[model samples]
Target: MSDSKSKRLRDPVHGLIVFAETEPLDLLAWELIDTPEFQRLRRIRQLGVSKFTFPGATHTRFAHSVGVFDNARTLTKVISREMKRNEQIFDAPRSEVAIIAALLHDLGHGPFSHTFEGVQESRGVKKRHETWTADIIRNPNGSIRGLLERYRVGFCEEVAKLLEAEDPQDIYHAVVSSSFDADRLDYLRRDKLMTGTGAGAIDFDWLIDNVRVAEIDIGAPEDDEPVNKVSTFCLASKALPAAEQFLLARYTLHQQVYFHKATRCAEHMIGKLLRSISTVANNGKNVEKMTGLRKEHPLIRFFGKNGECVENYLALDDTVIMGSLNALTAASDKTISEVADRLCNRRLYKTLDVADVGHDDGKKRQRQRTITRDFEAEIKAGSVMIDEKASISIYSEIGGDDDRTHKKLHILDGGKPVEISRLSDIIKALEKKEQFTRFYFEKEEDREKAQRKKGQNHD
Candidate 1:
C-alpha cells in the first residue's frame, strides 16, 4: 500500500510482472494485493490436492491472481490499441474495472481450493467461491471496500457488477469472464509449468496477437438464435489453430492432471471429513470433544452459521486446514480419525472407473446415489465409492469462441462475424461431451467398497 514506490512481482509464468507508480491502475492493484485478505491467497493452493499427484504443483492462488492481473492488463492494452486504430475513444474507467476485477477474482477461495468447496456442496450447501468474492469486494464489513471507496466513490460496485455479470456488457467485461478470459489464459500456462506437464501447452503469444475486438451475437441455436448482440473480445479467423490448441490443452489437463485418480481420491476423503465435522458440530453438543479439534479452531468458525460471512470465510486457508489434519487424526469420531490418518500418512484410496455409456448422466448419478446409501456406512472416510460425475465439453457454442458458457468467440470471416466453431473443424470435433465416473476404495479388509460391490452385482 506504499504510495510513492513502484512494485514488481517475480512470476514464473509472466516474469517480472510490475505495478508501476506511474500507472494509476498499477498502484491500485498494488494496494489491493498488499492487503492481508489478498495475501491470504498465498496460503491457498491454486491446484489444490493436485499437489499430491504432482509434487511440483504447489503454486498458490496469490501468484495466479497476479498473473491474471498481468494478462488482463495486456489484453486491455491490445483492445485500447485496437480502439485507437479504429478511431474509437478508449473507455479508461471500464478498463480499470477489468484489471481490478481480474486481480481480485479469486480472493474468496477457501482452504485446499475447490476441494473445500466440494465439501460444502456435498452437504447440500451451495456456497460458491464467486459469491464469497462478491461479498469480499462490496461488503461494507471488509477492508477491500474501504480501499475502493478511498480510490473513487462507487468504483467497488462497478468491479462487483462486472465480476457477477451474466453477459459480456463490453469487451472489458469479457476480459475477466469470457471463455478466453485472463483467468484461463494465465492458468493453462501456469499450471502446465507448475505441474511439469508438457502436454497442455498453447502458443499464447500467437493467440494474443490474433485476438481482436468485434461485435458478436449471443444465445444457443435451439434456445433461440441471436437474441442479443454486442461488441466484445474475439479472435481473428487466422488465429483458429491457436484457439484449437488452447481448448485441446485444457481438455488434456483435465484428463491428466486435474482428474488424476489420487487427487480425486484425496478430495473424496476430505469431503467426508468435512461432512462428518459439520454434522457433529451442527448437532450442538460438545463438538470440540467429539471432533478432538479445538473449540476455537478456524474450521469451527467456518462450518456453522458463521461460515456465511466473509470474515469467517477468510479465516481458513491451506496451511490452517492441512496443519489441523494432524490433530484431527486423533478425533473421537472414528471416520474423522481414519481419514485424517490416511491423509497425513499419504495412504490414498484406490479408484475404479464407473462411467456408463448406456446410462445417461442423471441415471448414472441415481445409480451411484443408491449405491452410496447402501454402502456409505462402511466407507469410514468418503461419501461413496464412486466420485461425482465429472463432465467436460471442449467445444460448446455457449462461450464466446468455441468454448464453455459465455458468448461464443467470434471471428470475422469474409468480413462477417461468424462463431469460431463454424470455421474450424478441429474445434468442432470436440463438441461432444465427455463424462467420467470413478469409484474409490479404502482397502481389501474393510467392508465391500463402491467398485467392488458394483463388480459383484454385475457378476
Candidate 2:
C-alpha cells in the first residue's frame, strides 16, 4: 500500500492524519472525496459563521472528516486487536461496521454548515443534516455509493442503518451517533486544539482505551423488544474522570467557543442574510438566475425584476455570505446596510452580561428592551443586543436506572465488572453541572444613554 504513504495530511488538530492506504479506499470513497458534495465541505466553514468571533476556527468539514476517519482507524485497531485475543466470542462483522461508520459519519452536512440549516429553520424549512447525509448516500448517482460498490462493500446501507431509525440496536450507530460517539469524541478534541481553547479538551485516548461494549435498557417505545436496549461503548471506573473531563470540555466549548456572544452575533447576521436570500429564491424565478450566482448574490439581487422573491438556499458558504455582507454594507436599505457594514467591519453588537435570573433579571431585560427600542427608533442603530447567560447540564444522575445514568462507565476490576461512578468523584460532580450558556444583546451607547436618562429621572 505505497499509496497509503502518499495519503498523509498534517492536521493542526491531530498533528498528522493518515488515510487507509492498505485497502486504498474503494472508488466510491475516492469519488466522494472528489465530488462537489465533499469538496463543498472545503468551502463550508466547520464552525459556520463562528469564525467572525474565533478567527482560527476557519477549519472545514473536509478536515473534520479526515480527522474522524483517523480517530476511527486508531480506535478500530485497538478494538480489532482486543477482539483477536478473544476471538471465540468477538463479533468481527460488528467491528468492521464500526470502522466504516466512523469513516462516513458526517456525509450529509450542507453549505454554510449548521448556520445554513439554522437560517432555514427561521423560514419554515425543516432539513436536517442527518437526513441530507442519508439522501446523498442513497442517491444512485452519488460517488460515495459507487466507491462502496468498488470495495464490494454495502457501505451506503451500513451508513444508512447507522443513522436511520430502523436499526436502533445497531452498534455502528452507537459508535457514530451516541452521546459518547466518535463524532463527539473527535470534535471535542479537534475543536479545542484548533481554537487554541481548552474548553473542548477531552481525554480521548483514555476514554477510547477504557471503552467497553455493553447493553442497557434506555426505556424507548420498544422497551419490551431488544431494539430498546442501547449498545454503548462506555468507560472503566478509572476512566470516569476522563469522561467527566470530556463532558466538561464539551460544556465549556459550547459556552465559551461555540456560543460565545460575538460568535452568536456573526451567526445571527449570517442567518438573517441567508433568510433574506431564500425568500427571494422561492419566488418562482427561473433557476438559472441562481446559476453562475450559485455562490453569493448581492442582497439587491434577491429581489426579482418585478420585486418578487426567490430562494436558492443550497448555494451559500461563509465566504459567499461574507462577500454578500461586504456588498450590502453599502446597500440603499438603511438597517440592512448598517447591519452588513457592522458585520463586515467586525463592529459586533455590544453584549451586556446579565447573570441574575429572578425579578431583577426581568427588570434588567425590560430596561434593555426599552433602551434597544429607543435606539432603533431614534438613532436607527442596530448594534444593541442583550446577552443573558444560561447553562444546561447533560450527564447527571450517577446511579439512576435511566439512560442518563444507565449509560454508565464500567471497569474490569480483577476481571469483575464495576460501575465507574463508584470510582470517580469528578464524574459524580460533572453529572450534575449545567452545560449551556445563554446571552442577550443590543446596541451599546443607546443602552448607556437610556440608563443615564433613567438615573437622572430617578435622582
Candidate 3:
C-alpha cells in the first residue's frame, strides 16, 4: 500500500467512489480533466436528442468521460496483479496507453454527437469521430495535441488506434470499441443511475474485477504459439451474461434514449436546417460562408456569416431548441421553420415501429413507401429528393464478411484463448440479434395530406 490519498468522486451510479491508496491513478484523470478538448465535452450532450424523449437523460459527455476514466482506473486495478506478474505481458507503458485511450476515446465527438455525424455521412461528407479524434490528437494547431507533446506522450496515433481498435480487432476490442469496453460499461451504469432507469444497469465492478489477460494473435511470430501478444480477455462464463447485458443495454438505450421519437424529430429538423443553410452557401449565395467551421457548426457561419446567427445553436441546449419552437410559432418559411418550432415545442412526429416488419417484407415495403411519400410532401420534393435525403446507418460490414460485431471479443477459457462467441452461448445469441433500431420521420399532418391526395394520382 502506497498510502495514496483519498480521491472520491460523487458518482451517480456507484455513489462516492473513493480511489484510496491507489497508485497515482490520477495521471489519466489530470490529463483529461482540464484539457480544452476534454472540456469541450461539457458542450456536447451524451444522449443527445434523447433528452427530448427522456427529460432525465440530459447528461453531458463530460460526465460520460469522467465515468469512463473511473471504469478504466477500476479495470487497471483489477488486472494490476496480473500485469505485475507478466511484466512483458502487460507493462506499465501499455497499461498507461489503455488508461489514456479510455479517457480520450470520445474526445472527437462533436455537437449533438452521432446525430450530426449521421447527417454528414448521408451527404457524402467523410467525417468520422475516430478520424477527427486522431486529427485533434496529432493536429499541431490544437491544444490537446500540444499538451500531449508537452508530456512527451506523443503517442496519439497509438492511443487513437486503441480507441479505434483497427483491424484483427479482437485483441484491442475491449479497450473502447466493444460492448464490454469502459465507455459502454460506464454509460450503461451511469445512464441507468441518472435516468432512474434500471433497464441499462450492469454489475460493472464484477466485470472489471473478473477481466483477464490472455495471449492474442496480434500478428504473432510463428514460434510464439505458447504465448504471443497478451491482451485483455475475460472468462467464458462471464462472457454470456456480460455480453447479453451489454448488448441488451445497448438495444434498450437506443430504443429509449437514442431514438426516442421527439429526439429524432428534433435531430431531423436540425439536419434539415443545416441542409438548407448549406444549400444557400454552396449555391453561389453571398450569405455568410460556413467553410472551415467545425463539423458541428459548419452551418453557423453560413446562417449569418459572422457573429453566430443562431446564438441559439451556441446556447442551443435541449431547452433552447424547445424554446426555439415557441419562438418560431409565427416565423416565415413555415415548413422548415415550423418543423424546428414544433420540435422545440414538443409537437413530436409520429413513429412507425418497424420491429415487427422484417427487412424485405411487402408490408414493410408498403410502410416505407408511405413514409417516403409523406417525407417528400412535407419537404415539397419528389422521389429523387427523398432518395437523396434518406439516411442509412454506416454498416461497417460493407464487404459482408466484416460485420459490426465481426470483431470478436476474446476470452481466456481455462487458460486457453478463444473467441467470445465460440465459448459463450449468450454472445452467440447476440450475434443473431439486431442491436439498433431505424426511425423514419414524417409529420402526421403531412402523412394525412399525402393520403388524401393519393386517390387523385397526383405526381
**Highest lDDT, which number?**
1
lDDT of 2 by residue, 336-438 (tens): 5666677778776654433223335455455545555555544333244333333334442211122343444455555454555555675556555342222
1 against 2, candidate with superior lDDT: 1
- Candidate 2 wrong stretches, greater than 4 Å: 1-6, 24-31, 81-97, 165-168, 199-201, 220-227, 284-314, 330-335, 356-390, 394-442, 449-459
Candidate 2: global Cα-lDDT? 0.56
Global lDDT scores for all candidate models: 0.77, 0.56, 0.55
Query: Order of candidates by TM-score, top first?
Result: 1, 2, 3
Candidate 2 residue 117 Cα shift, in angstroms, is 1.7
lDDT of 2 at 380: 36
Q: Candidate 1 at 143: error in angstroms?
A: 2.2
- Candidate 3 structure quality by residue, lDDT tens digits, 1-459: 233465666867657655544445464356456776677777777777666667787788888877887777666665666666567444556666677778787777756766666655666665677666776666565666655555445566667676654553433445565435677677766676556655744655556656666655544366655433545555445555665565556546555655455566567666665555445444534332222233243344323334322222333333333433443444343444555555655665554443335554455445455546556554454111232222222121211223434234566666776776676565566455333233334545544554454323322
Q: What TM-score does model 3 achieve against the real structure?
A: 0.73
TM-scores of the candidates are 0.89, 0.76, 0.73
Q: How does model 1 score by TM-score? A: 0.89
Model 1 vs truth, CA RMSD: 3.8
Clashes of 2: 32
- Those runs of model 1 whose alpha carbons end farther than 4 Å from true positions after fitting are 1-3, 220-226, 305-307, 355-383, 395-407, 445-459
